[model samples]
Target: MLDSGAVAEPFEREWFMRHPMRVAHDLVGAMLVVDRNGDQVVARIVEVEAYGGMEDLASHATMYRVGRETIGSAPGVLYMQRSYGLHTMTNIVAHE
Candidate 1:
């Protein structure tokens, strides 16, 4: 059992090597940790959407050249793109 205020161990890279659908489902409630310039930021992952490459028609990989490159690249690469010309959406390449 974990004590209150204790943070869980970070997930390993292998955790993301699984199929995207599994990754998305498992990510719910996980904590996202960001360390920048010695400052740490942590947030709870509340939602996620999985996009299967090539086989998924709704995936951005099917519609954009950038998406294809990003998805095809190695895992952990951040695929950052503008959403609907407004919000910036960030995704991580998975299943490499």
Candidate 2:
């Protein structure tokens, strides 16, 4: 479990209820704070990516059944992906 007790604020919750493109744009410069094993880890969100819905051919939600369901989950849910089995990427859900 995260030691920081990560919880969404009202403003952040509002942001998550919008379209992915909007959320992606607004997320730039945002801080991602996580408490890893009692150590605070912080990172700035310099880059953000927004994928079209399940119909988009390039979207994971379109290629995998699990991704489809995951993208549709409640806002603020964290989604993670592995890149070429080397790098780990993270995403947050935004639904209108």
Candidate 3:
């Protein structure tokens, strides 16, 4: 039998602590705009991937800590990085 009032495990606490945005709750439908040197671009954010901080290989967290390195142009904000040295890709974040 298990104790009903047992405290959450470390990993469980960490998981719960993660501030993830639900795809359906936050971004089922939304628009995104990008402007570079007077070039205006626009599109809707249809998909996203959440990297749970530094541990995630697909996240900037591993590369550097928040508010420290110039992580990239989109620090802390979710965005896609190009892959295979090919064409541009797309992504989004739950940053406010």
Q: Model 1, 13-78: lDDT tens per residue?
A: 777788888888988887767899999877777778899898899998899888987787766566
Candidate of highest TM-score = 1
lDDT agreement of model 1 with the native: 0.79
Worst 10 residues of 1 by lDDT: 1-10
The TM-score of candidate 2 is 0.78
The whole-model lDDT of each prediction reads 0.79, 0.78, 0.45
| Tens-digit lDDT track of model 3 for 1-96 | 334474432122222232545432444345555679999665655665555444557675565354123233332343455545695555433332
Order of candidate numbers by TM-score, starting with the best? 1, 2, 3
Worst 10 residues of 3 by lDDT: 9-18
Q: Judge candidate 2 against the unseen true structure and give its global Cα lDDT, from 0 to 1.
A: 0.78
- TM-scores of all models? 0.80, 0.78, 0.43
Off by over 4 Å in 2: 1-11
Query: Which of the two, 1 or 3, has more TM-score?
Result: 1
Q: How far is each candidate from the true structure, as Cα RMSD in Å?
A: 3.1, 5.3, 14.6
Cα displacement (angstroms), candidate 1, residue 49, comes to: 0.7
